[model samples]
Target: MIKMRNVTKYYPNHSEPALAEINVDVEKGEFIFLVGPSGSGKTTFIRLLLREILPTTGEIYVAGIDVLHLRPWKVPYLRRNIGCVFQDFKLLPNKTAEENVAFALEVLGRSQHVIREQVPEILKLVGLESQGHKFPSELSGGEQQRISIARALVNHPPILLADEPTGNLDPATSLELMALFDRINKMGTTVLVATHNREMVDSMRKRVIALENGRIVRDQVRGVYGYED
Candidate 1:
């Protein structure tokens, strides 16, 4: 559902491109991992998908929509098809878990009745039904992250993009989260998780797209983590 061709991104004042000559096609319902060290363009690729930054060159298509040709007014519409999670759970501090997940549907102008019906289902899917009333500060790191995931997925988005999602958690919690992602993928949502967690990547043995210095070095099915210590 994602296609990139010779994609390159250069930030102002940077001597080199953040992403260089990227080309890949990720099909629907596929679960993929973006594995890279810091500054290797994993975040850049995510931003490109989200249209947070424009590519300096090349093209991108998500679900057959040409990202480069999208009108300014259509950006939000494009994002509606994508669910994103980041390393620092970007939940509103004051909002409860249910409210946070509901907020996503609300922003889409979904009716209150729809929000009421969908929010709890998403929370339950993410394993946060019991804590929906708790604020982010009141929850454990893993719980907070799960809430974030719930918010992202509440819209039943076709593609889920997670960046460094397990960064702040302990191994056990990270494993739990990864298992949750696996479940999400199994339900037919395309999943792309960008992370540097070698152990988790190795254990999962999913498709790995390894990046180094803004270039794809490896793309393997049931791939092991290949970066050296």
Candidate 2:
């Protein structure tokens, strides 16, 4: 569902590229972890896939749309194929979890009836059905993240990209979230998480792509975190 070839991204006046010669493929329904220390280009990798910034050189395809050459006006359509979760919950303070989730569909011009139906289902999927009425501030850190996950999935995007998803949670909460991600993947959505949570990565033992200094150093099947965090 994701393919990259010789991708290189250089920023203005930076002596080094953010990502260098990246080539990788992620199959549909697969769960993959992007393991790296800070400034190791994991975020850069996701940004490239999202086409938030153009790669200096190389090719990228997400769900078969050529990201590098996609029309600017069509970027939204491309993004509809991918869900994004971040370290920060990024929820609107005033919006309840259900409204936040419904907002995603609303932006897509979905009918109120559709939003009403889909929003509850997505909340339930993330184990947040009982907390839908709560705002981000009213929820626990893990609960807020679950709401974020629900919002991201309300569109049923084929691919889910998470950057430092477990960064702000406790270990037990992080484990719970990871289990939710595993469940999501089993239901046939491709899941790619960029993280520094070695315990979570090691315990899950999924396909791991390790990055350092803007390059892929290891891509292993059923891999552990392998190195110290």
Candidate 3:
């Protein structure tokens, strides 16, 4: 579903590329973990897929669309096929969980009828059905993260990209979140998570891709978190 060929990204005036000679393929319905140390290009890799930043060299394809060459005006169309979540839980402080999820579809021009139908279902999917009326400040870290996941999935995007999704949670909460991600993957949404939680990665035993110094160092099926803490 996603392919990158010799992809490299260089920031302006930097001596080194953030990513170098990266080639990877992610098939539809696969759940993968991207594990790497700080500055190892995990975020760069996810940004490339989201087209948040253009690559300096090589090709990128998402769901068969040539991402590198896609026009700026067409970027929204591309994003409609991908959902994103981050460690920070970027939710509107004033908006309730239901409103936050509804906001995503609202921006996509989905009608009120559709938003009403989808918001509750997605909230329930993320195990937040009863908490949808609460604002971000009213929820715990895990609940907030679930709200974020609900918002990301409300559009029913085919691919979900999460960066350090459980970074701020306790071990039990992180495990719970991981189980939720597994459930989502089982429901046929391709899931890619960039994380530093070693225990969670090892326990999950999903495909793991390790990056270091801007290059892919290991790609293993049913892999553990192979790096030292």
Q: Write the per-residue lDDT of candidate 2 for residues 1-229, one digit (tens) a residue.
A: 9999999999999999999999999999999999888999999999988989999999999999999789999999999999999999899898898899998899999999899899989998998889988888899999999999998999999999999998999999999999999999999999999999988998998999999999999999999887874
After superposition on all CA atoms, how large is the RMSD of candidate 1? 0.8
Best candidate, lDDT: 3
Question: Model 1, stretches more than 4 Å misplaced?
Answer: none
TM-score, structure 3 vs. true: 0.98
Cα RMSD to the true fold for all candidates: 0.8, 0.7, 0.7
lDDT of 1 by residue, 90-146 (tens): 999988888999899988899999998998898888887899999899999999999
Clashes of each: 0, 0, 0
